[model samples]
Target: MSISTSAAPDTGRGPAEHDVRTQIIEAATAHFSHYGYDKTTVSDLAKAIGFSKAYIYKFFSSKQAIGEVICANCLGQIERDVLDALEGVQAPPERLRLLFTVIVASSLRLFFQDRRLYEIAVAAATDDWPSVQAYKHRIHQLVEEIIQAGRAAGVFESGTPLGNTSRAVYQVLVPYLNPVTLPHVSALHAEAPEALYQLVLRSLAPPA
Candidate 1:
């Protein structure tokens, strides 16, 4: 009886397929973050992770597929956090505070520590990626939902357009979430993220 000790290459299938896919995603995310999407290639990722190009191909049909997964993960995380903040919070004002605190802290972590991933995700999002756009729309909906809830609960003044305020908050916070943008905004406002968070809150604050 001959003993076969060589392990099979990853094919991204079967019961453990999810785990293999996750591994591939992690490796590809790091590569894309470091070298950027345009500069990074499937070959580079395979080489970096000691996997055969064929194995990677089996997992992801192309680099774009991997990028889609990364984008989905990023957006899903943000949605989850926002939803979590909204749940079990009675007061609309308190809900807004919780949401902003969670989001700002999360953004700070992503911008400062995982900047490469942030950059890669942001780039992928703007290049006509459908998944990216959908994810973004979901975030917009989250903001809109918060604004609507606040209005209905009488926490935000009536006649104020929640949609417009949602858009404003998104536009203002999105760019500042970038580390590069942080310094520029920080100098202007001093406390940067904190100030921006407060500014958004004040803008939405109900009368007196």
Candidate 2:
């Protein structure tokens, strides 16, 4: 999954307008971090940035629109981290392991380090935000790509349909990947990711 810029619809504005939009996003990020997303309103952001509510609306249609951009940015960083971890790893097994480990660690770091920003991710998942959906789709695509590579290398069995295998692997990852379920699983099964990763490797292995 590549790092995506923003999930919000592009306005096709000029550079000056784009600068204003970036300013609005940066201000909103700080405000959301300090005050929490649900507690803060667009009016609050306008005041914090010395812009009128009407002026803020020129950049974002609603508070949720601003939240979507922040959420996309957060998820994008996770994708970049995963890509970096997989760099120079030719083995499909190692690639799959890094994909699972890096994503879970990155998410946990976000939850602990910038918890308020993490709340935005929770809301995105709960509300079925487009950014969340797109993130999940990209993850699924990555899993499928790894599975294809493994099959081509004869590292994984080719009997199961590719789509089915990919979805199954993704399902195994959902508990860790989902913001809502992550804390719960982490609390109960801190070692679940490693255990699950090994299970997946065995399941994908070609018959003896």
lDDT tens digits by residue: candidate 1, 76-128: 56556767877888776666666656765655545456666766566664574
Model 1, residue 55: C-alpha shift (Å): 4.5
For model 2, what is the alpha-carbon lDDT of residue 82?
92
Tens digit per residue, CA lDDT, model 2, 56-164: 7876778988888888888888888999999999899999998888888887876658888888989999998888888899999999999999999999999999999
TM-score of structure candidate 1? 0.69
Poorly placed runs, candidate 2 (over 4 Å): 1-17, 188-190
What pairs collide in candidate 1? none
After superposing candidate 1 on the true structure, give the runs of residues whose Cα lies further than 4 Å from its correct spot.
1-19, 33-38, 48-55, 125-128, 177-183, 186-208
* Candidate 1 C-alpha RMSD relative to the actual structure: 7.7
Specify the poorest-scoring 10-residue window by lDDT in model 1: 1-10
Q: How close is candidate 2 to the true structure, as a TM-score?
A: 0.92
Query: What do the candidate models score in CA lDDT, each in turn?
Result: 0.64, 0.83
